[model samples]
Every structure is written in structure tokens, then in C-alpha cells.
Target: MAAVETVRGLVELTRPVNVIAASVLTFIGSFVAGGVTAYPLQTGAAVAATGLAVGAGNAINDYFDREIDRINQPERAIPRGAVSPRGALVFSVVLFAMAVGFAVTLPVVAIAIAGINLLALVAYTEYFKGLPGLGNALVAYLVGSTFLFGAAAVGEVGPAVVLAVLAAIATLTREIVKDVEDLEGDLEEGLNTLPIAVGERRALVIATGLLAVGVAASPIPYLLGYFGAAYLVVVVPADAIMLYGVARSFDDPTAGQVQLKYGMFLAALAFIIGRGALEFGGV
Candidate 1:
């Protein structure tokens, strides 16, 4: 039973849904941007490596923030005694090593990007969590790396690079809103999150502005003749709904599960759009 509990704890630590979402977004971007044809093996390895890295990063975060989790997330595996901190750290290290090893097999660009991501994850866990807007920016940047990784996987960097930029904008908006929703827990743990430092109302305003830009930009690929109408038709409503979620966040952050729900929605929509465009040769 003890061993089983430990396994379960590790599973929870991975946050499988989040891992899948990250991996899928990278997979979609790579497939759409011509990776499967150019470098299928490398692309598959990169995606697997990214998932491991993300999982490890999350575990490391929990390990480092054990004290804070004890307060803000007492029911979390480590804090609840389902997993030992030392054990978690070891697991995290192993995953990180695997991810790095896989990344090293790819192009030099992928290796460099993986190094940067590793560094950022460490910095975020070690010190940035207590910073203000800096923490938010770091999280957004890491999230943006998923789409960029796809581009790098195929040895092409222009189109996927643009998509990555757009992803960053959307991610930053959602991150700020999450800060608001988690404000209470973060404050109790003495985290200097944007919502705690600047207040919810102000954070909402900033998040709203960023989300507006992201939503409007969602149509740009179609307009630029890069993607077909599929992207436009699917993404417009998706972006609008996300924007609605952002607006609703102002009144009640908890009510705005859109931050989480719509991120996956957009990611799925992107995959569909990309596939549709490719199949029909419309774009």
C-alpha cells in the first residue's frame, strides 16, 4: 500500500493533463510546420523529451516549494505525506536527464533551446516565484517555448516562430488571470504574484489587454494567406470565447475556468486547422 501510494503521488505530480496539453501543442506545431516529412524521428523524440522536461520541472517546483505547498496546497502529495521530498527530487532529476539527453540528439538549436528552458525552470523555482511581474513573464516565456520547439524540431524556423510568438501572447494573458485565481493561496504562502502585488483589478486589466491583442491576432495567419479559412473559422469563435472568459475573470476569477479550459481548446483548434489546411491544400 505504501508503494502504491508513492506511485499515485508521482502520477499526480506529473499532472498528466497539463503534460499532454503541452506535448500535443508541440506535436501539432511540428506536424503542421513540416517536421514529420523532414525529420519524423527527431520530432517524435523532441516531443517526448519536452513532456518529460515539463513533468520534471513541475516536480522540482513542488519539491522546492514544499514549505509553501504545505500552507497553500496541503493536500498535495508531498505535503500530505504521500511522497517524500527527497524521493520527488530524485524522480525530477531523472526525468530532467532523460529530457536533456533526448534533446541533445536533435539539432544544435534544439539543444540550446532546451538549455535555456532548463535554466528558466530552475530560476523560476529557485527565486522568481517571489518576484512580481518577472515570475509571470518567465512562466509565459516557458509556455511559448512549446510552439517554438516544434519549429526547431524540423529545422525550419520562420512560420512556427510566428506561431510561437502568438502563443506567448495568449499564454501570458492566461497566466496573469491564473495569478488572480490563485491569489489567496499565493498570498498565504507569501508569494509576490502579480495579483498580490498589484491587486486583482489591475491584473485583470493587464490580462484583458493582452488577451485582446492575442484574440485579434488569431486571424492574422488566414489574412496573411498562410493558413486556410479553417483556421479562421475555428479560431475566431475560440478566441472570442477565451476573451469572454478573460472579461468574466474580472468579476470572479474562480468563475473563469476559461483560463485553463480555453488554452487546451485553442491548442486543439490549432491542430485541426493545421491538419485541415494540409489535407486540402487550401492554405
Candidate 2:
């Protein structure tokens, strides 16, 4: 049981939920780029590669953030002594290798994306994380690129770029909000996150501004005829939720974070459903 618990802790350290979410984005990208039946095997491979990459990235981030986690996330694997830093590093490297191996089986574009993402993940955790807006933007790009990687796997990017852009904007907003939430620990660790560099209030304003941009842009695909009414049905509500979150951030950054997180998920769902509806002649 002790060993099982340790294994579970190690898995949890990789943020499995986030990995799964990213994998879902990969599938959504494949579906949007070519439809559900297009390049099924390639889609599966992209999902696996994305999951591995995100999991590896999460582990490496935890390894680097062990000291900060000791204060901000005591229950984390490293902070709780469930995994050693060296062990986590090894785990991350192994996962990254597997991800790259999978990527190589796909097209050259996928391999290139995987390589770039791997380097970006390492750089973000090791160095860029200390820089305020730049770190957030890098993370946003990483998140958005998952869709592009999926499209690349299918040999075409198609309309998935719209989804990628939307995801990037929403993620950037959330990353900034998270920075605000972690301000105290970040300051203690001598990290100059946006909240610390520009003041919490300014950070909130910036986050809200980003969220507003995402909300405004959410309907672009439908208006451009890439999607349909079903897209509006779901995306409008998603936008409303994000807009509300942005408004609430002025008073409660924590609550705003929760709202944005849920809103982002809803927005992703909207993309999937909208695309499905169009493909199936639903709306």
C-alpha cells in the first residue's frame, strides 16, 4: 500500500487532469481540422504525445517549484516528500523522451512542434517563470500549440488555428490570475511574477483585459461561417462567464480564477460541440 501510494503521488505530481485536458484539446483539434474519421491513428498518437509532454512538463515544474510548493502547495508530491527532486527530474526526462519518440512517428511538423514545446517547457520552468508577462505568454503559447500540434499530426492545420488563438487568450488570462493567487509565495521565493512586478491591482487589470479580448473574439469563428448557431449557443455563455469573472476580479481574484477556469472549459466544450454540430448538420 505504501508503494502504491507513492506511485499515485508520482502520477499526481504530473497533474494528470491537466494532461488529460490537453489531450482532449489535441483530439478536438484533429476533429476540427478534418472531422472525427480523419487520421484516426494519427489523432491517437497526437493525444498520447500531448499527454506525455504535458505530464512531463508538469513534473519538471513541480521539481523546480518544490521550494515554493513547500509554502504554497504543501500537499504536492515533492513538498510532502512523496517524490524526490532527482526522481522527479528522471521521471520528467523519461516522459519527454517517450513524447519525442511518439512525435517522431508522425509528420515532420509534429516532430518540430514537439521539439519546440519540449524546449519551451524546460525554459519556462527553469528560467522564464521568473519573468512576469513573458512567462504567462509562454504558457499560453504552449497551451494553444497543443491544437496546432494535433492539426499537424493530421497533415493540416485548417481552421484549428482559431481555436488555438482562443485557447491562448483564455489561458493567458488564467495564468495571470494564477500569478495573482500565488503572489505571496512568489514574493517569498524572490520570483517577480506579474502581480509582484506590477502590483496585484495592475495584474488583475491586465488579466481582466485579456479575458475581455478572449470574450470579444469568441464569436469570430461563427461570424466567419466556420461554425454555426450551436457555436454561439455555447460560446456566448462561456463568454458571459469569463466576462463576469473579469468583473469579479476587481474584488476577488481567487473567485475570478475559479470562474475563468470553468469558463475556459466551457469554451473548449463549445468548440467541440459547435464543430460536431456543423459536421452532423445539427445547427
Candidate 3:
């Protein structure tokens, strides 16, 4: 029983859901680039690298955040005494090493993206997370880069660029809202988050404005003839939900951020559907 609990704790630190979700984003990016079947090796490498990287990132983040987790996330693996900080660090390092092994097999551009992502993931929690808007921006860029990484693996990065931008914008908005939600804990940690620097309301306003740009530009893929009308069928509702989430951030940052994630997930689904339409029927 004790061994099982420890195993679960280790797995929890990896946040498997996020790992899988990010991997799917990579796969979607490859699919949009029409590389899924054509460049099977590269696509597989990109997807596998993304999953391992995300898992490593999450574990390392938890390690770095253990102290803060006591205040902000009491039930987290380390905070709950389920995993030691050193153990988490070691786990993350192993995963990062494996991710690198997979990444080196990809195209030059994909390899570069993976290298940058690996460095960024390692540096984010320690060097960047405390720097007011910079932390949020770093997280956003990392999220977006996954799309580009996938496309680069297939040798056609144009279609995935748009998806990357959209994902980044949405991620930025959600990160801000999350900062707002964690104001008290962040303050206690002496972290200079966006909400701490600009004030929660102002940070939320900025997030809203940024997301507006993303929402407005959501139609670019279909407009550029990369996707079809079916894309809008899914994206419109996603945009609406995201808009609502940002608006609601003013009242309930936690709820807003959670709802915003659902919107982002929907948007990713839209990307898959839209690209499928283009690839299968050109509809």
C-alpha cells in the first residue's frame, strides 16, 4: 500500500493529463502540416519529446514550488509529503534527458525548438516566474512553441504558426487570470507576478485585451484557405467561451481561469477538426 501510494505521488507530480494534452497539441500541429503519415519518424519524435518535456517541466515546477505549494497548493506531492524535493528534481532531470534523446532525431528546426523549449522549461520556474509580465509571457510562448515544434518536424511550419499564436494568446490570458487567483499565495512567496505588479484588475484587463486579439484573429486560418468553414463552427463557440472567461476574471479569477482552460481545449479541438476538413475533403 505504501509503495502504491508513492507511485501515485510520483505520477501526480508529472500531471499526466497536461502531459497528454500537450502531446496532442504537438500531434495536431504535425497533422495540420500534413506530416502525420508522411513523416512518421519525425512526428513520433516530436510528440514523444513534447510529452516527456511537459512531464519534466511539471515535476520540476512542483519541486521548485514545493515551498509555495504549502501555501498555494497544500495537497501537492511535495507539500503533502508524498515526494521529496530532491526526488522530484531527479525525476524531472531523467525525463528531460529522455526528451532530449527523442528531440535530437527531428529536423533541424524541430531540434532547435525542442532545445529552446527544454532550456525554457528548466529556467521558467526559477529564473523567470518571478518577473511580473515576463513570467506569463514565457509560459505563453512555451505553450505556443509546441505547435511550431510539431510543424517543423514535418518540414511545413506555415499552418502551425497560426495555431501557435492562437495558443500563446489564450495561454497568456489564462496565466494572467491564474496569477490573479493566486494573488495571496504569490504575495506570500514574494513573487512579482503580473497581478502583483500591475494590480489584479489591470492585469486582468491586459489579459482580456490580449485574448481579444487572439479571438479576432481566430478566423485567419480559414481566411487563408488553410481550413474550411467547419473550422468556424467550432472556433466561434470557443472564442465566445474564452471571451466570457476573460470577462468573468474580474469577478472570480479561479473560476475564470478554469473556464478559460475549457475554452482553450475546445480551440485545440477546433484546430484538429479544421485541419481534418482541409486534409480529408478540402471542405
Q: Over 4 Å off in model 3, which ranges?
A: none
Best by lDDT: 3
| Number of the top-ranking candidate, with TM-score as the measure | 3
lDDT (10s digit) by residue, model 3, range 167-254: 9999999999999999998999999998899898899999999999999999999999878788999999999999999999899998
Off by over 4 Å in 2: none
Residues 1-283 of candidate 2 have per-residue lDDT tens digits of: 7688679878997898899899999988888887448688888889999999999999999999999999999999888888889989999999999998888888888889889999999899789998989999999999999889988899988688888999999999988988888888899999999889989899888888887888888888887666778988999889888888867877787898889888888888998888888878857
Candidate 2 C-alpha error for residue 218, in Å: 0.9
Residue 27 of candidate 1: its Cα lDDT?
A: 77
| lDDT (10s digit) by residue, model 1, range 1-283 | 9999999999888778778877877776676677776788988988998899889988898999888788767998899999899999999999999998888887787778889998887778789977877887888788778777866877865666656767777777777887888877788777888888888899889988887787777766666655777776677667767777888888877666465367546745765575568557766
Clashes of each: 0, 0, 0
Model 2 accuracy (lDDT, Cα): 0.88
Every model: Cα RMSD to truth: 1.7, 1.2, 0.8
Q: What is the lDDT of candidate 1?
A: 0.78
